[model samples]
Target: MIYIFLAVAFSVAVSVLLKVARSRGIDIVQAVATNYVVAALLAVLLLGATPEAAIEAKATWTPLVLLGVLLPAIFLVLARSVRSVGIVRTDVAQRLSLFVSLFAAFAFLGDTLTQAKALGIALALAAVLCVLWRPERGATERGGWAAPLAVLAGFGAIDICFKLVAQAGAPFASALLASFLIAMVLCWIAVLVRAATRAAPVTARSLGFGVLLGAANFANILFYVRGHQALPNSPALVFASMNVGVVVVGTLVGAFGFKERLAPVNWLGIALAIGAIGVMASS
Candidate 1:
């Protein structure tokens, strides 16, 4: 439970840091790129991840490459979502991405489609609509829906890629490290391109924030993994607690800490998201 709490805190802290980064005019791309540097180091030092495992004969390169591509891309989208839609919607959208993976499980992964899972998917779809709702000339910035919706889909795809990597027999930590290293390379490419084009200059400040973001991001994964290891028999419990905890904590931080406003429908969406997770977990 303490691990779950820490996981939730670090998860929300990532969004908070993104929000602050935007406010402080930090180069998000550079910061995110540098984030993978710290994350990869932690994976090696703490998780004992090694690249050799990822390069073994049984491992597949396709999913690893896809994960590498999607990780930084989705991270950028997540930053945009947080900047435009605020933490509340972005976090809910991210958690609800399980629906995408759930669909894939039923359609492609040969998982049985149970009634509870079906109901959970329905609830999640409803939650997406409700959470993304913005009244005409509302408080939310214009085009706010785009980034969060992208977030929902992007994360869903990343989840599928991770599943593919697992099915390929690549150890989790190794796959993670490989993906981070790839993402770091790709991110730096983007940063250099932007700098060359005079779009954004790389700065020490962004790198510093990147280190913090990476620490929080890595801490989130570390604690969540520890929580699962701590309660190996209760995977559903850990999954439910982690998802529901992020949604609840993110909402509080967005509403009070950041003063992000939400309509009643958005509140309904949050409830529905939690209910959906509970249903899926119970199923």
Candidate 2:
């Protein structure tokens, strides 16, 4: 339970850091690059992962490379989503990515889809529609859905990649380290490309915020992974609780702390998201 709460807290803290980055006019690309580097270092120090071990794990590299490419791309998309749509919607969409993971479970992993899981997916789809539908502007708004949709799909793909990594039987810490290292290289390439194009000069402030962001991001993953390990037989509970906690807390913070306005349907979506998690967990 403490691990669950810590995961939730750190997850929310990530969104908060990105939100603050937007407020402070930080160069998010640079910050994200720095974040990967910091997270990789922390994984080495805290998780006791050796680069040599990761390098020798042949089965891990495919997912590790995919994750490396996807992590920064998704982080950029997440930052955009947080900035454009506020934390509540972004967080909801992010958690709803569980649908994709479940779909992958059924499609590629040979997991049987029970009725409850099917219904949960249906309800979650409805929740996404409701949450993203803008009031008084019809269903489609000007560029409103893009970031949220990207966040949804991006996170889902990431979840699938993690499942693949786990299936390979690599150590969690080493796998994470490998992914982070790859992500760092990819992000730095982007940073270098942008610097060459005069996008923005890298600054120390970005590095500072990135350290904070990296610590929180790694902590979130570490705690969530540890929590699941601690409750190996009750994965459903951990999944349901973690997602529910993030959605609920994100909505509250977005609404009250950030003064983001939500239509009634968005509130309904939040409720449905909670229900969907419960239903899926039961399955």
Candidate 3:
């Protein structure tokens, strides 16, 4: 559908933007936090001045807020991971999201688990490691190995949150609000942690970057939330595939666009990523 393609395109653009913004000396975490703020404002606007719709959407708020809390911490880290590790492996970590989400769905939402999903998870984990692994002698050895792992854990939790929030059926915008508020809280906590540790004092640059990042990040998620309505399919497939698309795009970006080269062993991770997507699609 046109909406699906639009969703994919918007998402890709966001991914590319993250990569591009880093070169501008943007603080990835701050930028992401800003994006959430921008997105939250939009969500509030969409929720409208009336109280009725907002009240009815309380169910949606809970999950969205919970997601909001988790995402900033996870995605803020992801922004760093992407910069340190490159988009390819970052995307691979995202693919593993499906496996975590699948379990959450089965356990909490009572969704049926097929053998196809299990196989997909196994392949996805392999794919993630493959993408994250760099074979070079020195610097390449540590090229975001830990970052990808952290992203893997964060994004897995994110997948389930997305599913739960999707089911909430609030104005979608309400859910976005919850997400933003939570993310804001978590991000600020990080800032506090940095400050307490006597890291650099809050600079205008960090604040500005956080604001910009939040605005764009808000746009990024708003698109995802609106995508379900725009695309008529179940959000599950759409979300999963959107993640897969990110990997493909990130890999290409790293390899060709950014000139972030990888060894043959690492390329296998990309291949496995492709395979994992196939399994997800089929499942």
Candidate 4:
């Protein structure tokens, strides 16, 4: 129960951090890379002298190793999509990844697909559709298939990597640590390449925002990892709940705190997300 609350809280924090980081003129890719570096460092400090132990425990670095390539690749693409597609659309596309992940987990990994899980997955789908439903006059000046399409692909890939890691015969903590490390290295390389291509000025404002992002994002990942470990059988429904929580919080913060307006359908989507999460968890 506590794990559930913590996971929701972590998702909310991530929402807040993303907005704050953007406001400070921090590049999303840079911010994400910094967060991964921070998360990797924390994992190293906490798990010290245990690489061999962790690797031995997992025996198959397959999932974590794949995450190394999968995370940075999609994340960079998602960052671009966020700017072009807008947050609402991007969130919807990412959460719609529930369908992709649930299918993969069921077909390949044999994760539980009970009625309760299906109900949860359905609610999650409703939320995604609602979030993506643009009002009649809501179209932006730009309309391109590239960004949204790429974001969807990126999210689906991420979900696949997560499901694979979950199915690996290893301690969840070890798998998590290895995955973070791999992601950290890949992101670092990306950051260097960006630095060489163009000078991204990291002002005090950017630095401060990155640090705050690192804190919240790392905390989010840590809590999520813990909740994943505590939850049995690595149900895709649980991950669906995580995405639904993000939508709920993002909508609330956007409406009240940020004064962003929502159409009627968007509001319905928010309610559906909450209700779905409620049904999925308490059933």
lDDT of every predicted structure (CA atoms): 0.92, 0.89, 0.66, 0.63
Stretches off by above 4 angstroms in model 1 are 57-59, 136-142
Candidate 1's clash total is: 0
Compared with the true structure, model 4 gives a TM-score of 0.74
**Candidate 3, residues 1-283: lDDT per residue as tens digits?**
3444455555555556666665876656656656666666766685442323433665655656667677777766676777787766676776666677777787788888788887887887787666766766453566567777787777778767666656755444554565666777777677777668877356667677666555555555555656666666676666656666666766776678878878887888778877877787767
Order the candidates by TM-score, highest first — what do you get?
Answer: 1, 2, 3, 4
TM-scores, all candidates, are 0.96, 0.94, 0.77, 0.74
- lDDT per residue as tens, model 1, 24-109: 97888999999999999999999999977785734458888888899988878888999888999999999999999999999999
lDDT minimum window of 10 residues, candidate 2: 50-59
What local lDDT does model 3 show for residue 88? Answer: 69
Model 4 stretches astray by more than 4 angstroms: 1-7, 46-49, 53-59, 73-99, 111-119, 137-156, 199-208, 224-245
Model 3 scores a C-alpha lDDT of 0.66
In angstroms, give how far residue 59 of model 1 lies from its true place.
Answer: 5.5
- Report the Cα lDDT for residue 77, model 2: 91
Best by TM-score: 1
Candidate 3 error regions (>4 Å): 1-6, 9-29, 46-66, 107-109, 137-143, 165-171, 186-204, 225-227, 233-241
lDDT of 4 by residue, 25-103 (tens): 7776667667776766776676442445446645356666877777666655655655554555555566565556665
